[model samples]
Target chain A: METKKKKPRYDFILILILAVAGLGILAFAFLTGGGGASVEVSVDGRIIAVYPLSDNREEVINTPEGKNRLEIKDGRVRVTDADCPDKLCVNQGWISMKGQSVICLPHKLTVKITGEEAPESKGADIVVK
Target chain B: MKDNKGKNNIRQKQYIRSVTSHGMLVAMAIVLSWLEAQIPAFFAVPGMKLGITNIVVVTALYKMSSPSAMGINILRIILVSFMFGGPSAMIYSLSGGMLSTLIMILLKKIRHFSITAVSIAGGVFHNIGQVAAAAVILNTDGIFWYLSVLWFTGMVTGTLIGILSSQLVKRLPDSLFSLRSGGTK
Candidate 1:
């Protein structure tokens, strides 16, 4: 009877390398800023967006113009009736999560929800666990 | 005729043909990912669409070794992004493919489970990976709602691809390929 060698041993070594590499990357993610709590953005019953809670955000009112009239009333977002067409800001429901964004293209106004900025200065959407 | 089975020394080269080798597998995977770009996977329910490329990922996982599958996956995501999937596909493809491969390979180690089972496991893991990425990107747990939908899709697609791969692998000649005489050692 003829004999045949088993499949090449290359696969075992290659798998080891890949596994180690994958684990290394995961570990790096944990060690880096990824381990930090994430950010979420919501608008009333409908969630428009979500993003990291990093400080890399700016409030429309915080700008030099310093005129931000958008606010949350009775758990609903109100645009204070800006000059935006379709009154989209009025359509935007609420901002109770991270990364939530409501744009009023015509009025040149927007409502953004982020982790660092919420009802209170301290982050409330996320409980670090 | 039976004598040909053991005597045809030159016929033992199909198992690892260069065109079907790991590199080719990687290239085809990339091409599959790129080609899938034209397809409209989104049902318009939300920002996310149903990812169909997991079919190819599951198939590749079964036909090739774990590392080879990983190789194919990484290349597919990179090449697909350069071609059509844009940043969104890049993120989901890489995460889904990587984690799926991990689950498929680990399941392959089980003695009794078949490739179909491996594919199911891969699909589940792929969803897990996608959801994880979604969580990271959205930075919120609200995106978890998408998992149930993905799981249903995964089960069906995974089974189909797994069956196809198993049949294909079965038909392949179980032997090591030899380099062509004109080819170098």
Candidate 2:
């Protein structure tokens, strides 16, 4: 028998790189997401309503397909119920961070947490470089 | 004339064999898609799926040609959409499937990337394509935030699929892919 050298079969380093990249992106997303001032509801891409996070309220969004119950409480918003088939939006639970959203694909409805204009920034032409 | 006839016979056999295998793989893909849908959404994040059908696609890519894998994926998405999904769902799946398959094919050409790495790329791109489609259709960028969560889940599911398909590629008899001894190249 002759001794032979074999090349490594798996690219484990690639997997590690991807894992770290994914985690880094997730951390960035979390760190940059928060301080939402209001919850906005939209149907068919049109803004239907905007509610302040300070107020706890329940509202129903009616789309061409069906109805979705949007609930905002304690600065977080969620879809409590929907007539859509998958009910994925309802399952999405609550989201409070800015840019977070609960989307009902079937109904074409979206409940999103948005960072409204800061009071100081309102009616001010703040220049940025 | 006799030699030409024999060659034609072998070619016909190979064609039949390839067709049958493609059909079987497509059926498997459709079944996997359906089975995945049956599972309740355990995660609280939207656009999250176990991507069980990806196992079939990855197996096809390694066992067969790129076109075969792409065809199986597209056919499965269309058929499943007809049965269980709506027009919007079809659009999302089509975009995701096409993008993922394209990426996997490109990755397969490179020597350093293993099957798992290719699969992870496929999974991640699939989510990206879907989210892009959603952002376009829904006319909002807020939902793009889901990409953060989806990328993580894609990597996890892609690893599982890559491992499973690698096993299948190793264990399955080559005769399953090439029935005739000396068929097509």
Candidate 3:
């Protein structure tokens, strides 16, 4: 009989709070991710290159760790190929909005989209900050 | 002397019983891990898993002692990693498994929280632990961006595993644990 003890009200409330909090954070992430103008590529936390989303090109980014082929087309950026083990970056498909990124953990690679400010013009400013 | 001999026999039986049960639980968890891996990368978010294996761990926590559950979990992680993953994957699993099991054990100790609540905490902390491991290993905070999505997924999956575990804990006979705890008596 003890095994069937009714669940305490606290459990329900706690679960509800956790669920609502999770959804709220997800919603905030989506809302804050806005339309951006350029693609920024970084390896080991250092920005290696920035390309305007307007351009269409395919280039292989060679990092000391590995290589990832970046493709920018139709105002979107994606990793078409990678030599890393997981290939999660390639699987991440595409990103065209601010704050959205395709990360490859093995290669320590991050491809993120940045808003408005031209990447090339403010690249040095970003480093200083 | 006779009583001591009987007690020793009971202890031996309990040891065998616990080992067999732990082996079964570990096997079930490994099967679940492999099954989860088979599910094609359904979510675009990398490193996200449906976490079905948690059902076994949650059930173990309620049916068995915390130390026993923790043992089963660690054994499963090591075996599953060897079978289907690499050293990096093993590190992530170890961190997540340890943290989540600790949280679940703590939550269960509170007495007020239900099985579902404990399971939810386990699920959420599992993702946090994994993300933290990845951030440290990769040396970048950008991975934190996935935390939000991972949280949402964790909550949803946690609810499911919770429901399943509660049902399992209800159905499994009490004799299973009594054999372990009541051995000396």
Model 3, chain A: how large is the TM-score?
A: 0.83
Query: What is the two-chain DockQ of model 1?
Result: 0.06
Chain A TM-score of each candidate structure, as shown: 0.35, 0.80, 0.83
In candidate 1, position A66 carries an lDDT of 28
**Candidate 1: docking tier:** incorrect
Work out the TM-score per prediction.
0.50, 0.89, 0.83
Tens digit per residue, CA lDDT, model 2, A1-129: 111346464568767776787778777767777789977777888877777777777877778999998887997888898888878898889888888888888888887777883223221222221
Candidate order (TM-score) = 2, 3, 1
Give the TM-score between model 2's chain B and the true chain B. Answer: 0.95
Tens digit of per-residue lDDT, candidate 2, span B1-185: 99999999889888998999999999999999999999987777777887889888888888788999999999999999999998889999999989999999988877467787888888988998898899899887675478878988888888888888877877777678865654333
lDDT of each: 0.50, 0.82, 0.81
DockQ metric for all predictions: 0.06, 0.40, 0.40
| DockQ measured for candidate 3 | 0.40
Complex DockQ, candidate 2: 0.40
Pairwise TM-score winner, candidates 2 and 3: 2
Best by lDDT: 2
Which ten residues in a row are the worst by lDDT in model 3 chain B?
B176-185
